[model samples]
Target: MNAEPTTPTTRATDEHLLSIDALAAWIGVSPHTVRKWVTRGPATGLVPRMLRINGQIRFRPDDVRVWLDTKEIQ
Candidate 1:
């Protein structure tokens, strides 16, 4: 069976880029914490995988999902 091919529009819609507040809400943290996570160093091991777009910070939903998966403690 042939699956429907994905389009740019569909992919763009599916990959939501979140704001600091939105990401914080999704992860149960405060906006300040999220800001710290993004701005802090590698030592924290809590830096978010984000993009700097036009001087604004943006976080892809997929990146956040992957980060969360990596953080799972055994």
Candidate 2:
């Protein structure tokens, strides 16, 4: 089985995730900007993927750190 964040095996309550607004605040950008990156749709985007907790968007802290690291190097 794929061990993706969206996997049901992983419960949202298992970890403290970052919401779109929180991520935006941390990145010094607007929540709308973060939303755009998450909705890359057909094309690849900044955030690899987002987690859905009770129909709300969430993100893993580790993933955010790695993503920021990659962007810093670029």
Candidate 3:
């Protein structure tokens, strides 16, 4: 009997990962701006919800949503 090759599995929760470009588009900013925001020190007042995996930066959709809510003016 031949066995099927197994493919690497990713958790369903990983679907929330957003690339820098995607996050920038969602927040109406350039990708370079997002990169700078994430890379700056905490004193710069940038959101702290970021993930760096395999040298690629990603953001969580839920975290971004929460950050936006916290930044509301009203």
State the lDDT of candidate 1 residue by residue for 1-74, as single tens digits: 77999566644455668998999999899999988877785357695677889998888888888889988999
* Reference-based TM-score, model 1: 0.73
Best by TM-score: 1
Compute the lDDT of residue 71 as modeled in candidate 2.
72
Backbone atom clashes (below 3 Å) for every candidate: 0, 0, 0
- Which window of ten consecutive residues has the lowest lDDT sum in model 1? 6-15
- As a whole number from 0 to 100, the lDDT of residue 16 in candidate 2 is 75
Q: What Cα-based lDDT does every candidate model obtain?
A: 0.81, 0.77, 0.80
lDDT of 2 by residue, 23-74 (tens): 9998899999888887774146577457788999898887778777877754
Q: Which candidate is the best by lDDT?
A: 1
Model 3 lDDT, residue 16, Cα: 66
Report the C-alpha lDDT of model 3 over 1-74, residue by residue, as the tens digit: 75988776964565568998998898898988888887784346675478889999887888788888888898
